[model samples]
Target: MLEQKHMALLEEAERRAIAPTDNIRACFELLALTGAIDRDCAVRLARHRLSEGKFVLLFLLHDKPDGLSPHELAERAGVTRATITGLLDGLERDGFIARRGGLEDRRKIAVALTEVGRQMARELFSEHTQWVASLFEGFTADERKTLHELLQRIWRNLDAGKQQTGQTADARA
Candidate 1:
């Protein structure tokens, strides 16, 4: 139950200005925690010369030996096709991925990992897995489940708010 460094400042600022209720304060805490996790992970990934997005692409490609199309990768990675292309270019240049025409659909090209890429994926994934686990090492299984459910509820609430506001899926981008 360790609090973030900014929690005290946040409490002070809220008390002096726009004071949030307990529920709203909890929401802010969750947002801050998620942001911290994302920021720290990005920094760590930079040490491996990888961005979070590139790591995701490599990991996804590792599980799909048959390879995926750029369109498929874009969808799976939740990014635009243009972004996937850039990722593929960097990976290809680094000898981590190769693109080839489909045997069945000659017009379509698929991206797959090289042997070097596979090894890189395994090593990176293993270490990153431990790093993430370490962040929640003290949480019991039940507490973890409760936290997951709570987060999902918050996500649904936010998504529903977007829908109510006439926001299209594209608007999220």
Candidate 2:
């Protein structure tokens, strides 16, 4: 169910022969929902002086006490090494993380969370879990499972389209 304004826009597009099909409308709604979620998440992180990238880095480091290399982090985060480097710089400056020689390979560097970072991750994970769970509060367990399956189907469709078009995941970037 779209908002009144969105419905009106869709109707207008159809009237003008813009061909606003059901698939397009569904895509639009998905984008709008994701945008709202992103905004809300940003606001929540802002309260703790953290960005999404920094939070993700902290979350990853929190689970792996031994830490990860910059390349590994970038791959896991689905970001570029340069992006990870920038995030690490800010986290290190804020005393949230430290870069030290790798345990097994002294030549390589590992990014580990500081004690402060660990504490922050613990606190944020608690609040974040609750907030995320709240988003699906209206759905029953079966509905949640169905939604997950539907979302996975949509993702597969997207992947198929990308493959057919010879477009890599990072092409949009």
lDDT at 167, model 1: 68
* Clashing residue pairs for model 2: none
Q: Residues 1-173, candidate 2, lDDT per residue (tens digit)?
A: 47667788778888887774687689779878998899999999999889999999888889899999999999998999899999999999999999999999999999999999999999999999999999998899999999999987787578786787677868866
RMSD (Cα, Å) of candidate 1?
5.6
In terms of lDDT, the best-performing candidate is 2
TM-score of each: 0.74, 0.78
Displacement of residue 82 (Cα, Å) in model 2 is 0.7
Model 1 error, position 6 (Å): 8.9
Model 1 lDDT tens row, 38-67: 989999888877888889999999988879
lDDT of each: 0.85, 0.90
